[model samples]
Target: MPADLCPADAALAARLPQGVLRDPAPAYLEEPRGRWLGQAGLIAAPRDTAECAAIIRACAEARVPVVPRGGGTGLVGGQVMSQGPAPLVLSLERMTAIRSIHPDEGVMIAESGVTLHAAREAAARVGRQFPLSLASQGSAQIGGVLATNAGGVNVLRYGNARALCLGIEAVLPSGEVMHDLKRLRKDNTGYDLRDLLIGAEGTLGIITAASLVLAPVPAETGVALLVVDGPEAALTLLSLAQARMAGGVTAFEMIAGQGLRFLAEAFPEMRQPFPAPPDWSVLIEVGLPDGLSAQAALEGLFAAGVEAGLASDGVIAQSGREAAELWALREHIPLANRHVGAIANHDISLPLSEIARFIADAGAMIAAEGDMRINCFGHLGDGNLHYNFFPAPGRTREDYDQYRKPMTRRIHEMVVARGGSFSAEHGVGRLKAADLAEWGDPARLAAMRAIKAALDPVGIMNPGVILA
Candidate 1:
């Protein structure tokens, strides 16, 4: 630890809400590098925007780097307090509150600390859908979701967190709250600052509360499992679903045979969504507008797909429980993957047209690396793939750790070559900061740096993320 950059002093700690800070035990230090902890530091939980703003002000005054945290579900270690003069962990978990739900206006305002699942439930109570549902919704807070601009299964129809958000209330780096909490669908503002902070990964500002746009709960939602030969057929089926179903198609997820096998072996509850496992499967959902027939829309797509040779067989969910079970198979992947072995995970995106080709080529390239199992699956509708390379069947955990950096670089380069992104839904936390510096465009990097410098002149807020 840098002697000059030690833990926060008594004065600073006293300013925080009582019992809101923790200095990790010495034994907890030097355990491992991960999302949760980073050396010994002060972790402060504030109750509201005012408390958060006050914490920021104190940190700014002390030239202390403040890492804003919401649920700490971030994969990239962005929320860890690692550096600077008494780097402080600014947690918003205590401020969780669903402020209001305006069903008529289709807006739900909630504190940043509110869990996504909580927000979704609150919206559902009024017969609306928040539409930013994700695997981590149970623990991922609204602030973290907005900070990462999280995209989930329904992004094909409802868009990502950025699109679902109408306006944000954030504390800028200079300790001033930029409150633009209006629920307006159209605002001809001189500058859309809300957008700036949405995906900034807490580097530019600290999100406090947000006004999120809600959609009326779909009158009917149909889920199905379509077995296809491969990625090409999956793409074809997606095109067919989009064309034949009109605006009803919401989610179109593709899972490879290998990924399915892994899940089946790892998770006992996850059955094969097909009678006979095919090379690939598309988990689709169609959200019918009022007076539209969801079942008819899916049945037509299935018939057309079989006729066109895009799908070999399919199963339409007969009830809500069936639909939820079918979705559970897709949503339980990350958890199931953990039981397999250590894996290098990549959240990447390419053009919809390039997906099939990229999957084919990337799979072959990765195979050449030798002795690794590839569990590749994701939201094919939006061109995002969670391409995870599992450790060799018998390799020790340490062996897998050794390949982390080099393998990640190789895969990222391959993704980049196919006009894909290295980081898709997951934002650049500490894990990707070096990669951003290495592969990111210089001009784009400059703009990000300028914004960081302008908003956080002292670099007190969530530094070493995207810009650093």
Candidate 2:
């Protein structure tokens, strides 16, 4: 109930259900990165799909923009609208419900507001797992996960959010509820609207609920950390593991010495297994069938890697606690980076063959130009690296603020030149919309614009997002 709310918006608010309207709060106005503060004429948290549709219909008639919000954990600005007329922020936090789960068919139909952690727990109850694992899963909702097509560590094996989703139910910009949440594995429909909305980042519509795929839990799992000479050796070791594991490789993450140093600097009390962090290492996980020893499998892989000169040393987790500790090191790298404060970060993905080359070239170029510290690491199995730049010792991020933009543009240019993406897992929210426009193909840009104009004639859905 903002004092400046337009008359049409006020009338629309009166027409909605009693509990749907919410008071504006700071959480709904800002994204995680604190890049911008949003303006909302109204906040609507619908408890069900019917209420969600009603709110959208009223907004449609009154021509008020609608910005769909999930868990407010998005790194991009998709959850907020900073400019234009104040919008109605449609939050899906109250719509969390797992409608049904068919373990036999490996599918779970859940409302969009269901947090990823809840879905995973629900699947675990039936001896299955939801493979899309992100550090923010505790707060990231299923709708937003699908909307952004997020990719996490397991993407090396289970694939991205788009692949795990079987179907989705979304409300189009015009307030029409598209009930396409099918459990069928194969549906050769005329046009797959489900695919469009999954990665549209709410520009086309707001996703309400979805049918997600659940994977069977592996009988045995093992984790290991191996020291590699460099990115090239890491890539070679990955190939060796894949050839031997035969689809058993669960995750293959690359870690740089710089990342470990930052962790030590940020969290002095955190236990690090290595006496001194190697220049480069990879933490790999494997899953095997019953009666197969995961530890033995990893031991064999490690021996082979060493013989082939791909890895020099390694450590295999002996128990669940040890495995969790090892994984903790890899997961904490981002937190360490945040604590150190980066001047520039690029979530770029390169062709598998071009990864090592890009890293070497980019690292060298940046090093030759300045005293910036580089921490390049991520899901090397998928060629997506979080290439970040930090100020040198005794310096702050503000000291090199001028280099953030040009450095990001340069890094993205290098990635695109190698036939990779500028925005790998994160959707092209407001942050990278300009990059998308400058680097996107002419034909693809035209098609996207046409789709936007056709689907949202009044353009009330998440304006100032993907498109320029």
Candidate 3:
């Protein structure tokens, strides 16, 4: 077992300019899902990269475990160490700074603690767009975003967090700073250490700052909500939109009727675009150049979809305000889901062709187990789905707690059988370490273990994460 932070570490705490908090508050111990309540003897917020390095060095020397924390907005238990020795929680909250912005070069260097919303606004100030967006953008920090390689709605066009990051400045397990914050578009280095560390979930190293890629603001943008027949029809509509709009399709999200119903039940004030939610519908956004009209493109796609019988009805946003309102609905679905409570929540991805089949099969499999409510929705453009299970009407999640484990296992097995990932954007954290071990290829698992041993031999960096 790893050693806990004790009074002997007072000298190291004194060296940190930002100081340490001995009492781990509810904010530091609890995760968003409330699945894990962590225990920590010390909570240190470093003001700078050097201070972060010193704290890590002290932990390494003392052979004490250190859990790197960000905004604590992670759905998984990555930010919290649940069942381990009381460790030092190193938070990057104090290091929130925009180091530099190069609008001409389309890049920005920001400290890890900078929230995604701040980064987006910074890019907007320079007339550039950071493109990466999520429901948690208001609280999710750059470090945690890149660490888990998050994928959100815009991932259909902008790619994940790993793609947005060009380089990172990180502190290794031994307290050595790996300063490779280059804005270069092309770097032919021996090994891509930046890529390795980005999705490592702080198990390899803790990212302090990053150089991120930005995009030119779209000249025209529009959002459309289209009613589809089912997952198959949604897929057809996606292909049609891609064929018609090409690179203009910025986001293609699918929402099941149950999700819309839940939104209505939980948040009655929020306007529903459709009078009655279709069994399956899609929210598509298009970003076009100056000459091309996004509204026209969406109308064209809608007309084609209707003619092809892929879509039954649709509505397009008439203004920027309308577009944001439409996005607000999409973003608030998760909140509605939380209010309803979930028995099992899954974030999985499948090959584009297998999505419809997997959804159909998984629904059937879950139905066989029990009469549960399933909300199947997500970024259909990129083949990632939030396949969540909830209690039946007039029921509570606790009433079905006994089935959570078996239902999750069934879902994961079906996903893996269909060549889908058990954990899509959510990192392995403490929750999915066993799933990773079971589904991960033996060769890849071995290589990951070796890399962890090489970079964090003492396992001081976020212990019990990614690896067992």
Best by TM-score: 2
Model 1: per-residue lDDT, tens digit, 1-468?
Answer: 222333356667766656666545442222123434464356677788888888788888878778777776777777665554446777788888888889999999999989999999998999998988788888899999999999999999999999999999999887899989999989997889999999998998899999999998889889998888788889988988898877688999998777777777887666666654567889999998789878888888888999999888888999999999889888877876777755588989999898878778878887887778877899999999998888776775467676777888888998888888999998888778888898898999998888888888988777778765
Residue 306 in model 3: lDDT: 91
Q: Model 1, poorest ten-residue lDDT window?
A: 26-35
The deviation in Å at residue 430 for candidate 1 is: 1.1
Q: Which consecutive 10 residues in model 2 have the weakest lDDT in total?
A: 1-10
lDDT of 2 by residue, 1-468 (tens): 545667777887888877788887899998977888999889999999988988888888888899999988887799998899889999999999999999999999999999999999999999999999888889999999999999999998999999999898988888899999899889997899999998899999889999999999999999999999999999999999999989999999999999999999998898888899899999999998999999999999999998999999989999999999999999999999999999987888988899999989999989887999999999999988889999999999999978888888889999999999999898888999999999999999999999999999888989988998
Q: Rate the local accuracy (lDDT) of all candidates.
A: 0.82, 0.92, 0.90
Give the backbone clash total of model 1. 0
User: How would you order the candidates by TM-score, starting with the best?
Assistant: 2, 3, 1
lDDT of 3 by residue, 61-108 (tens): 878789888888888799898776778898889899999999999999
Q: Identify the leading candidate in terms of lDDT.
A: 2
Which residue pairs collide in model 2, if any? none
Better of 1 and 2 by TM-score: 2
TM-score of each: 0.94, 0.98, 0.97
